[model samples]
Target: MTTLTLNAALHLDDFSLEVDEQIPLQAITALFGASGAGKTTLLRIVSGLHREAKARIALNGEVWQDSDNGIFVPPHLRSAGYIFQDIRLFSHLTVAGNLEFGRRRAAAGDGPALEDVIRIFDLKSLLQRAPDSLSGGELQRVSIARALLRNPTLLLMDEPLSALDARRKSEILPYIEKLPERFGLPVLYVTHNVDEVARLASRIVLLSQGRVIAHGDATEVLARTDLKPLADHLDPGAVLEATVIEHRGGMATLGVGTQRLRVPGISVESGIDVRIRIQARDVALAIQQPQGLSIRNVLDARILKIEHYGEILAEVLLDVGGQQLRSSITREAAEELHLQQDIAVYALIKSVAIDVGLAG
Candidate 1:
């Protein structure tokens, strides 16, 4: 399998950024951290925008930067497409002109055709319009289309949705989600939003104070109780891939690994796959399958592990038909219910607690 390796150290004023790890190039890896966590700096280093004394970076066995070997590739020669948060489109150029510039800069026989990129991003209609006249979402789409036209091997996106409103963010997210599939390119996405990480990333690299805290599968990283403090006020949860089985009467039925979940108010059509994030706090535990309950989702689960958070709350990991589900409850309730590893319990989840808009 192809991989991207990084081992570098940089000292700037009082802050130091040190990264030593290997990332798989097969999936979209999210470089996630809070502001000032050096997420963007790492991307810049990989793109050859930042240079350090002992830096070394290799992608798919090809060396881009090797300080010992006295090799350093410039940013423009690194074959990376970088999209900034501001959607940096040339104000003087029309959409078509900007795209042509990207195509002209590509290496011989590299990247996709201009017409294919336009059709994929739905940018054909905006070809003649200036960048200044486009909306935030439209500009972002154009920016991404231009990047694809460059035919880069790797794509770097730095908070591409941060400048847009909720509506605009929603509009551009679908395009971002399809980029990896529509074009075979490894993406290194930098963002502080856990929702975005959960929705789009296959792997995650968690950074804190210019250091790597954890890096692994997106679902596994989010379920870690030890890293909860760095999660930016978002509840730790599990992400499950499910298919919409049916939708009727404002409810959507989802099939997840032999279990069924009924979520309220999902607008997706049946048979389409969607990702659902279920926060641990939204789930409650029951000793027995209760009767006459208002909660619509109660699945038979087996306790996998228990970890205490602070003094009062405990996070319980459960296995629901091979899929991991988490629930956070008070220690008192956990003890009263006799929760332990391998014990069977019922997980109660309210349908309304699920926000369908976050599903992608």
Candidate 2:
């Protein structure tokens, strides 16, 4: 398996950052944390922009830095494409010119052809347009195209969508989701947005106070109550991978394991796999399957574990046809329903609660 290892420590004026971990290079690995948590600092360290005295950084056996060995490869020498929050396109250059500049700096036979990247990013029409004339979303597309033209082995994105408004973010997210599959490149994405992590991240690294608090599959990491304080503001949720089976009567049918779910209308065609996010609070548990109800989705599930967040709220983990589903409810409700491990129950999800915007 491809991996990136970093063992480093840095002391700032008010805080110290220490990172010692081996990150598996998946299609997209999210570096998630709030402000001042060293998310950007870690990205800088990986890109060789920042250095630590005892740092040792390596990617797939290639040593980029080793303080003990007296070896340090500069930022430009590393095959990494760094995209900042700001769209750093050259204002004086046309879109094509910027892309050409990246192609020129690429290592010999490193990445895709310029024309291919342009096509993938749908930048053909914007070739002659100047950066200043492009919209925020369009500028981001151009910047990403330029990075691809550079033939980077590892792509580092530091809150690439944070600068854009909601509409612009929605416009660029589909493109970002395609990067890993289109180029087979490993990406380290830094973001505080839980929705983005749910949509794009295959693996996640949770950071707090410059330390890695959790790292694992995106679903598992999000479900842990230990990270509740970190993500409570976002209304922590679970991500489910499902396939679109059919669409009719303004509703889309999705297959999750052996069970079927009806959700709000989705634009994608049938047979396309999608990732769905359901907030824990949006799910409700039932002791017996209901007969008449407005709710459309009711899946049979068995209780796996129950965790009390505080005196009033609790998070229940349920096994739904072999897939995990989380439901957050009042402690009184859980006790009234006699919720316990190995007990069978039903999960009721409202169709509107399913966030289709985060689907990918």
Q: Residue-wise lDDT of candidate 2 within 6-84, one digit each (tens)?
A: 7778887887888899999888999998888899988998899986646899999899999888989999999999998
| Clash count, predicted structure 1 | 1
Write down the worst ten-residue block by lDDT for model 2.
Answer: 228-237
What TM-score, to 2 decimals, does candidate 1 have?
Answer: 0.68
Candidate 2 colliding pairs: none
Report the backbone clash tally of model 2. Answer: 0
State the local distance difference test value for candidate 2: 0.85
TM-scores for all predictions? 0.68, 0.69
In Å, residue 192's CA in model 1 sits off its true spot by: 0.3
lDDT of 1 by residue, 18-130 (tens): 99999986557899988898898888898898876368998887899998889998888888899988888998899999999898898556579888888888888999999
